[model samples]
Target: MKKNKTMVEIWQDVVEIKDLIRSIILSFIFTFGVYLFVSPNNKAKELFFGLVGAVMGFVITNVFIKPKRIIIFDKNKIKE
Candidate 1:
């Protein structure tokens, strides 16, 4: 018989460090793209905005997008 898994267990087992790192890197690139487009006026403002963008990007990607992708990937992996 097979054991049923909880959401927490599935996430813990499926999400990997490499995936997290990849997400972070992708997020950074996205943040950098925004920074380039905006062209902030002052050095301080630029730095602050860049940092904020990077953090927001990381959080959004890590908290939301990554898990969804991981869940889909895990489901496919299990099916294979």
Candidate 2:
């Protein structure tokens, strides 16, 4: 037997995955910068800052910025 998902569930999962990946990538980038800036004095503080920065960056990108394009295809244009 196979399980079925509703449209809402499918979309929710997609959004969740997108946000998780985005946060991780952003966090890494932020961590790198923090490591450079504060590694000499406070390593732990740098890590804390990096995590905060990542969350802020992800929220800003996801909520304030709009994506440039959406991938929609025209069926009639397909070559059969």
Candidate 3:
């Protein structure tokens, strides 16, 4: 008999730690860039919102983004 897999089980394989980390880092960089452009005069506000942006970025990417899959098809093969 085969066992049924739950949604969580299926998703566990799809979610990756590296991707999460990358997303968080990217968010930090983006937030910093925006901060520089906006020139927030308060250091406390900058630090606090940067942290928030990082966490939000991680969660959003993890929940909504999936790794891309690449597939190659060859049409030149001949059947004997």
Candidate 4:
């Protein structure tokens, strides 16, 4: 039997389950790693660092993964 690819629509955008899971795992690892490795004495510091790590992960995913789009141009739609 052939397996079908799973896709979900989020905010009117389509996303693959595999990609979503991978992104989640990467973000979780980065967020926790930074939070735990940094000084544990201050709660505020840890929270701030964790947020930074999450942002870093977001950037990493955006940089590494690209969105798929097929854009078509219609001459009739163009106004000169």
Candidate 5:
């Protein structure tokens, strides 16, 4: 028999996947940004710096922006 999962659980899975994709994009952007900064003629150096920047961006975002916000809801106002 298979267990059923709630909508919230499905949403959470989607959110996790989105986060993973975002991290990859962020890393790629960072790498490109670093390459622009270096302005190196050699492709190898540019790639190296870009990779470093990508890793840096990914780490920074994960460390500082991954936390969730807390909000409280009031039921009294809605129960007219």
Candidate 6:
């Protein structure tokens, strides 16, 4: 069965609304979760940890979620 996708344009890019929301939630969770582990007194540490968290979130999101788009190449467009 083919499932219909609900896509929307945000900042001139089209994305599935559901996936966008999921990405937001997951990134927030990972960012905040890791941020919480660092001591509150050190601002630099917090920033570093938060950035690491964001990267982790990006990687995890990519791992679990597949891209909804496909690219097609025109053979005639590129001639060797």
> What is the full ranking by TM-score, best candidate first?
6, 4, 1, 5, 3, 2
Q: How close is candidate 1 to the true structure, as a TM-score?
A: 0.48
**Which candidate's TM-score is highest?**
6
Q: Write the per-residue lDDT of candidate 4 for residues 1-80, one digit (tens) a residue.
A: 23675778887788777778878888888888888886376889889999988988888877765564467886786668
Off by over 4 Å in 5: 1-15, 64-80
TM-score for candidate 3, residues paired by index: 0.38
lDDT of 6 by residue, 9-79 (tens): 78777788888889989999899888997537588988989988988999999997777668788677665
Q: Candidate 1: which pairs clash?
A: none
Instruction: Please give the lDDT score at residue 24 for candidate 6.
Output: 89
Clashing pairs in 3: none
lDDT value for model 1: 0.64
C-alpha lDDT score of every prediction, in listed order:
0.64, 0.57, 0.60, 0.78, 0.65, 0.84
Order the candidate numbers by lDDT, best to worst. Answer: 6, 4, 5, 1, 3, 2
List candidate 3 segments past 4 Å from native. Answer: 1-26, 33-39, 65-80
lDDT for 16 in candidate 2 is: 40
Candidate 2, 1-80: lDDT as tens digits: 13442222343343344545665676677666656664456667777776666666666666743443367886786678
Best by lDDT: 6
Of the two candidates 1 and 3, the one with more favorable lDDT, higher being better, is: 1
Backbone-clash count (model 3): 0
Candidate number that wins on TM-score, 5 or 6: 6
How much RMSD separates candidate 6 from the native structure?
Answer: 2.5
Cα lDDT of model 1 by residue, 1-80, tens digit: 13442223244455545555668687888688667766478888787778777877887786754453432334444543
> In angstroms, how far off is 32's CA in candidate 4?
0.8
Clashes of each: 0, 0, 0, 0, 0, 0
For residue 11, model 5's alpha carbon misses the true position, in angstroms, by: 19
